[model samples]
Target: MRGKAVVVTGGTRGVGAGIAAAFVRAGAEVVVCARRPPEKPVEGAVFAPLDLRDPQAVRGFFEALARVDVLVNNAGGTPYRLLAQSEAERHARVLELNLTAPLTATLAAYDRLRRARGSVVMIGSVSGTRPSPGAAAYGAAKAGLENLARSMAVEWAPDIRVNTLVLGMVRTELSALHYGGEDGVEAVSRTVPAGRLADPVEVGEAAVFLASDAAAYISGASLLVHGGGERPAYLDAATVNKEE
Candidate 1:
């Protein structure tokens, strides 16, 4: 990744921050953008201020960008709530952020990517593959996102590679808000087959691989970065009837 120019959207914090930091450590010139600024400067990354939800702003951002060799679309999250209780507007908002924003950004950056023969790594979620109970809309949006990546891969073939890193639970600074506390974190972690949440750095490493020459042959792939994913409930249900 040395000497490469990388752009990471929603790179102010959480998984996005980790991805940008990793690229910087690999000697890439990283440009990170978010609606708000990070609490502190990331050592080797330059910050770009923009809201990706606005199509015009997004288009302008990419047009004004220097040179990019990698683009990591990592800005997305769900506001956990049951679908029935949420308003249609709220659901649409989530979809716009999770799906539309990335699409707009990708299209805006297409030419530069083609010129550089660069890669685009989208930060997807495992919820898209399974039934997301509390966050139904988010799941639907992510499913669309994965499909969009596949289409983009074909449309931009031989010039750019597009892939997704479908993630599970990750331990970030925001973990406390989502998992409650240490005990809550442990309780949630236990549900995963790996018995732990993923480290953000590990996710960064995966992104690096997908963006590097090593994964040059890989395109339109949805790589599961979950900690073995959640265990099926039926396994334990069946165990209940077993003899001692």
Candidate 2:
């Protein structure tokens, strides 16, 4: 990765920061972007404030870049909002952030990526693969994102590579908001086959591998970074013997 210029959206903290750090370790010149600066610094990386939702700003951000070898579309999230709890506009906002924003960024960076034969790593969620009762919009957007990546891979083939990192419950600074306090987190962890939430660094490492030459020829693929995924609910409620 030496001499490669990498861009990580929403890399100020959490999974984004972890990805940035990994790239830095791999000797890439990493630029981390977000709406605001990181509260804590990611050593060996530069910070660039960006609002991915704004098309004009996104274009300008990419246009100003001299070179781009890789793009990590890691900026996106949603609060817990049941389908009926929020207005359509609210749900639209979630879609804009999770789906539209990445598309905007990719379009803006297309020229540079094509020039460099670069790769794109999309940060996706398990919510997209299953029912998301509380975050329906986010789930829909992520599912769309993976589909979009597949299409992009087909359309932009032989020039750029695009893939998604399908992630599950990850322990970050904001974990408690989704899983509650420590006990809540523990209970949730027990439900996963891996018996624990993933660390941001783990997600980062996977992203790095997908972007690296090791994964060459891999495109339009969804890599699950989840810890063996969630356990089936029916298994625990079955009438079978405890020892099987």
Candidate 3:
């Protein structure tokens, strides 16, 4: 990755920060962008301010970049809201952040990416594959995001590669908030087959691998960063007992 220029959207903290730091360690010129600055920025990485939701701003941001070898669309999140409890506008906003933002950024960076034969790595979620009861909008948007990447890969074939990293629960600085508190986090972690939550750095390494030459032949692939995924709930209620 030496001499390469990598751009990570919303890379100021958490999973995004981890990804940016990984690129820096790989000797790439990493640029971390977000609406706000990092509390403690990654060492050896440059910072750029960006809000992915703004189309014109996104275009301008890309145009200002001298070079781009990789683009990681990692900006997105949605509060836990029941489908019937929230307004239609609120759900729509979730769609815009998780789905439309990536599209806008990709389109804006198309020229530079094509020029450098760069690749794109989208941060997806496992919620898209299952029934996301509380965060339905986020899941729906992620599902759409995965589909978009597949089509983008085909359309931009022989030029730029596109892929997705479908993640499960990651232990970030904000994990406590999302998972209730420490006790809640531990309870949730035990539910996964791996017996623990995923580390942000692990996700970062996976993202790096996908964008590296190691994955040159890979495109439109959905790499699962989940820690063996959650254990099936049905087993607990199964009438038939298994001999251990």
Across 1-244, the per-residue lDDT of candidate 1 in tens digits comes to: 9999999999888899889889999889999999999997677999999999999999999999778799999999888989889789999999999999999999999989999999999999999999999898899989999999999999899899999999999999889788899989999999998989998888988999999999999999999999888788888888576889
Clashing pairs in 3: none
Per TM-score, what order, best first?
A: 2, 3, 1
In angstroms, how far off is 192's CA in candidate 1?
Answer: 1.4
What is the TM-score (0 to 1) of candidate 2?
Answer: 0.98
14-39 per-residue lDDT for model 2 (tens digits): 88998999999999999999999999
**What ranking of all candidate models by lDDT puts the best one first?**
2, 3, 1
TM-score of each: 0.97, 0.98, 0.97
In candidate 1 the C-alpha lDDT for residue 180 amounts to 91
Task: Go through the candidates in order and give each one's C-alpha lDDT.
Answer: 0.92, 0.94, 0.94
Can you write out model 3's per-residue Cα lDDT over 1-244, one digit (the tens) per residue?
8889999999989999899989988889999889999999999999988888889999999999999999999999999999999899999999999999999999999999999999999999999999999999999999999999999999999899999999999999999999899999999999999999988888889999999999999999999999999778899878798766
Residue 145 CA displacement from its true place in model 3, Å: 0.4
The parts of candidate 2 lying over 4 Å away from their true place are: none
Q: Weakest 10 consecutive residues, lDDT, candidate 1?
A: 232-241
Q: For model 2, what is the error of residue 237's alpha carbon versus the real structure, in angstroms, after optimal superposition? A: 0.9
Supply the global lDDT for candidate 1: 0.92
